[model samples]
Target: MNGENAYLATLMELFGRANFETRRPRTPEAFRLDPIRRLLEGWGNPHRRYAVVHIAGTKGKGSTAAMAEAILRAAGYRTGLYTSPHLHTMRERIRIGGELISPSTVVELFGRLRPAIEADPDLTVFDILTAMGFLAFAEAGVEIAVVEVGLGGRLDSTNVVSPAVCLITALSMDHTEILGPTLAHIAFEKAGILKPGVPAVTAPQTEEAMAVLRQVATERGVPLWTLEGWRYGPEEVAPSGQRGKIQAPDGASWSIRLPLLGRHQWENAALAVAAAIRLREQGWIIPDEAVREGLERVRWPGRFEILREEPPLVLDGAHNDASAARLAETAAEVFPGRRWGVIFGVSADKDPMAILAPLRPLVERIWLTRSRHPRAADPQRLAEAAQALGLPGRIRSEVAYALEEALAEDIPVLVTGSLFVVAEAREAWAAWGRMPMPEVDPIPVRVGGR
Candidate 1:
């Protein structure tokens, strides 16, 4: 029996227990599924007690999973949502019906898991979290669990389930070190969630990526649905938010006003609608009203999130090249003809230039910074790369200070390059009691020639 403070410390210790999430240690060993499977089996297989909606991808995985879970909750079902790489708190990684898992849940689970965890000392923090998610969903009596893959899907700890419907969002080249270097190789790793006789859906993918997905789905005897048949209308962009329409091949249409503003939000929303329609067909009993409410209620912070309006600050966790390019496009759309000052920080494992190239033309100037995360690249190193790439930027060392430096320029500010950067900035904004982006507003038309 522990108090809330002790429970918080225990969670921190559990996170620090694994070198996988925080410290960018060299490839210590191959990712194994057996430990998590065995742990769950020992716990009476709690994961098997509930239906699963598994999602995996290089980008948009978290957003898509959040959307799915929200839809489930809005439809009046008890739902469990699990996402990785917590922005602020470890409890954010586990949610039941749109709320963070209670500290009591953590304390109780710790009590039950101590023996199994102590017995198998090799289980990673991710493994323990996966086990906890299963147990939480089971204990909460959730009807469905929306589980986001922590990394590549095949060997990812969350892949143990044969989901009712599996989803693979837009795939790109992130986590190439563990997954693979090329798009096809990465696609193979993401496609690992496809199971026999289960329906799977994917966003529009590249020829190379699509070929691999089709091949894998075929080999797995899965019925694959492609987003090619889906059409998402362009967002009527606004400072407050965006409104868009999504039409599935089955003629399920939804006009949604999304609060999570960005380039790819509509596409992500469309994917969610498609998955929901499939879930309805599978007898989930979700109605159109629930879908609309779910889309409106869904909040995925740090993905092109508007934090304030005085200087028009945006916090997006666009860490990879594809996401960075989309961020640039969305910024151009939102703030037409307006130059932006960007505060950028990225992980060491990422290619800073790939992220910077697409973003360069959109940025007036850059403030390079390092996040508190150990995987953050050195600010000096990022500044050197930026100058060599002809993108002018200065180093600020700390993420919050860099944000301040960027905000001082009196232009719209963008904090991107990593979620870790946005997470750090968000903590500061919370401390200052800055208001959040308005839920919904119309897009103001901008004329050229400032």
Candidate 2:
């Protein structure tokens, strides 16, 4: 195979293994960390070599992790960031100093990991990717890594780390099949990252979720910090970004500007600020200015991302009802009085009505579509679902084709539902506008284990 093909083949080999991200676990027991733990043991546990900030939540966890990594990086600390469900490339899951892990490095790391991978027939694709992230961080001499839990906290592969700080963003009902049926059950799973004596900070949560987290923290002897005394509010919200201010517990306040939009992101920023303060208390040398700069300059694409200006095109990865609600609110707030032509798609496992209901009032018409993801819901099914919700839409099998049709409308356009859909829309926009592509076309979406 040629060099590009070689890299693609290597990635395919890894994705061909059991993957829970593309497929739901059969039961909660199916998510055990034993295989990953044993696999890491064989590699000498590179994750233990660096300090970590572990975060888990139904929403905003990725944004919180990205903000924390940016803050640490701005403080001159070599940082590694590991997130999940990559928008474009598998390499986006692992980053050092805000750069994606190169394809060659992924190939090299997979080659190094192959022997152990072969020995353990039970390892999932996420398990292998988690191993690659830890090994890459160790190899790159990362001082601290911000790790976002791929799924629930307790059995997640990333939970292997004993983090310097744990952060749980605002919790809501999500992954009800895997985590549980209620908010408290979901909170219990998210609180699984809480280690004894490891201080954790949380965003504002429902009383049910907060109570569970407190019980878990008290049982684990983890000192948990809530955003009780902290204060934050958005000063301005615009298409480009938003300006916000936060008043931390210690009475120190910061005026911040964030590239990521939405009122929820302001909350995520406050949570990051709280986590950074906890890190400072641990003597990490993060200054006030670093926090501000990191919060301001942090680049988390695909979350309320404005991909174009005139006749606005917004892209967001709001798959769940709570996040979709936020996306709807933000979209309406930012582009007031403009009826939107929305291109919507989502995973089969998600509730389409719960997602579409939030956007109904804001939407004039929908271009129902499916991403290339194996788990993506059928567009024809989505069209029928949208009809039930009193919304009108036509079906499109491809995201680019859907976008082409949606943009032809004179109103604002929104491409959302799943990160996978947004990723495809992003690439289509880039291609149509002759913008630079990534090192490779997004890793092939024909993944297995579904």
Candidate 3:
């Protein structure tokens, strides 16, 4: 194989050998920066060499981080973006300036770091990947690195950075087992990223979550800026899911346009813009035009993404209640008085009722299918769960079969409930359309585990 293919194969060989989720998962020992710190120490602490923006939240974190990266990139900064649980390729998790690190790069990094990784077999896959991102960004000489918290912020591998400005996106309850059972507990986990005197930009959150965040910020003496305080409401909501004349933190406002659908995204864009502006205040020097250009140019796939135009195949990875509610609300606003078919699947750990309860009213028919991932809830079980909610749906074992059935009706199909499900559907769609879904080895874990 060539360099790229060789690198890809090497990554597959490395991660494919270990169980990603269950291997050394849920070790919440108090925020030890040692794993990354040690790896960085071995690699000469590359993460410290670059300025960073650390983002942590229950929801909208990825989108907000992507927006921040886009804004920084638009402003002519050599940027590195690291997000988690990629929808398509593993390379999607680590990128420098919109280009994914080559497979050869991954192979080379793994080879270089193998001695360290092998010495400590206790480290999770995420920790090693986090190291790779830092090393890659450092080697590439990126000016700024936008890091998204992989799991709960307290013990997540990505929390090692002392960001220039920390951003907490809209908070909600999802990772109850690892983060916490209550919103406050979860908020505390998200707030773990706050450092002494670092300014934080956040979107409007629940009174409970906000209270905890405020308490944390107060104790740390870190300034907290709320997106709600940033003014300007929607001047017009177009049928095409576009908004006009959004107000900024400054007295001057601009007509904001986002390619992504949903009003929640408008809030997310506002948060990104607010965070970018705050970064500028901290000596980044990003222009207003760059902010506008970034917002317009931002592309977060699998979040209210419209894949096919003719029949309107919409894909959203709203795996939990808050995201599902947002998806339902956005659908109602974007396609008012219209019903769409839904191809749904979610992880076994997720509260299926919480997700489907709000969505059932809007969907014409539900095609339940299990994602190819091991953690995916069985389609039959999901269908039963929906039925318990009085929203009956058909079950299919395979994703492609369900997609075909949903598409046969010629109505708009909304594929959602889990990011893994969305990714699988996208892969199937790509295969069906004769497009290449970059070849990666199947994670060694069984479909439903051993």
Clash count for each candidate, listed in order shown = 0, 0, 1
Looking at candidate 2, the ten consecutive residues that score lowest on lDDT are: 441-450
TM-scores for candidates 1 onward, in order? 0.94, 0.97, 0.93
Best by TM-score: 2
lDDT of every predicted structure (CA atoms): 0.82, 0.88, 0.80
Q: How accurate is candidate 1 locally (lDDT)?
A: 0.82
TM-score of 1: 0.94
Instruction: List all candidate RMSDs to the true structure.
Output: 6.3, 1.6, 2.7
Worst 10 residues of 3 by lDDT: 441-450
Model 2, CA-based lDDT: 0.88
Q: Assess candidate 2 and give its TM-score to the true structure.
A: 0.97
What's the TM for model 3?
0.93
Ranked by TM-score from best down, the candidates are: 2, 1, 3
Per residue, candidate 2 scores C-alpha lDDT tens digits across 144-169 of 99999988899999999989999999
Off by over 4 Å in 3: 1-5, 16-27, 30-32, 232-241, 434-450
What value of lDDT does candidate 3 attain over all alpha carbons? 0.80
Clashing pairs in 3: 7-103
Model 2: which residue pairs collide? none
Per-residue error (Å), model 3, residue 210: 0.9
